[model samples]
Target: MAHVDPSAPLEGKASKETERKLKRESRTQIVSFVFMVFITTTAFLTVASDVIPSGFAIPFILLLASVQVIMQLYYFMHMNAKGTGWVNALIWGGLFVAAMTVAALMLLIGITKY
Candidate 1:
């Protein structure tokens, strides 16, 4: 058998691939963070100012909040990474159930009659 080098530099193809992957992840995280901040500021301004009506602002802010939650889950929680298939399935299923429950409640409350 041949002796192995103990002090070899980690500069092979695998290292390069990992470096590129890290760079791409960093860029995506930065972009997502900026988007989250923008959404938050927009929501705050919408509520602080009288430009948008309350009825429109509420729904708009809710939509933005949901988008922000999705971003947080995918980026911060790494839900899009490998080996997270089951986690994704569970989270999405929970969301579906919650949405259905809310829809049922809304229907019972006669929201469409307004």
Candidate 2:
């Protein structure tokens, strides 16, 4: 038996299907990254511009932030990939619980304020 180097780089051309998949994935990542950058720029502009009132800018920035978070999770984190059903469910469940907790706390605080 011959010893082999485990850390050696892989050799040979990948299959057509694999190459195509890789190209598609790279394209998607590029697009998502561009989109995220655009979103960030828009958020910064919204906050920096004096024409937009603080009332509107705050919510607009928040909306952009939410979109960025979702994109990061789905694309950068590969949450949208196959065989991630359980992971997706658990993450969504956690989000739901967090949202509900925030809502309940807001309501409690509001009631106590009165």
Candidate 3:
């Protein structure tokens, strides 16, 4: 058995847990970045193809983008893992109001006839 020295710093078990959390965080960020890149590239291709013209597709794309952004913010941003209920509730409330406002305008304005 090796002798322990009080003067020297010793390795603590917390280091392993800290490292694991860091790795998980790094992985989450990388995955989020990859997903963002994929979404952006797909958006770019859709815009370039013009098969789904911006006039017809922009709103749909915007909705998907909002979802993806929320996913990243909630996950990789650690909002879901660390935030209080009030914080999350506030975010959801904002999203709901934004959606409701957009829906009201679109419906009231008769923007989508098709």
**Predicted structure with the largest TM-score when compared to the true one:** 2
lDDT of 1 at 99: 96
TM-score of 2: 0.75
* Span of ten consecutive residues with least summed lDDT in model 3: 75-84
Tens-digit per-residue lDDT, 1-114, candidate 1: 297787887564657888999899899999999999999999999999987899999999999999999999999899989999999999999999999999998898897676
How do these models rank on lDDT, best leading? 2, 1, 3
- Model 2, position 96, has a per-residue lDDT of 99
The clash count for each model shown is: 0, 0, 0
lDDT of 1 at 7: 89
Worst 10 residues of 2 by lDDT: 1-10
- Sort all candidates by TM-score, best to worst: 2, 1, 3
Put down candidate 2 lDDT per residue, 1-114, tens digits, no spaces. Answer: 398998999899999999999999999999999999999999999888889999989998999999999999999999999999999999999999999999999999999999
lDDT of 2 at 75: 95
Local distance difference test, each candidate:
0.93, 0.95, 0.79
Top-lDDT structure, candidate number: 2
* Residue ranges of candidate 3 with Cα displaced over 4 Å: 1-14, 52-60, 105-114
Per-candidate TM equals 0.70, 0.75, 0.65
The Cα error of candidate 3 at residue 99, in Å, is: 2.0
Whole-model lDDT for model 1 versus the true structure? 0.93
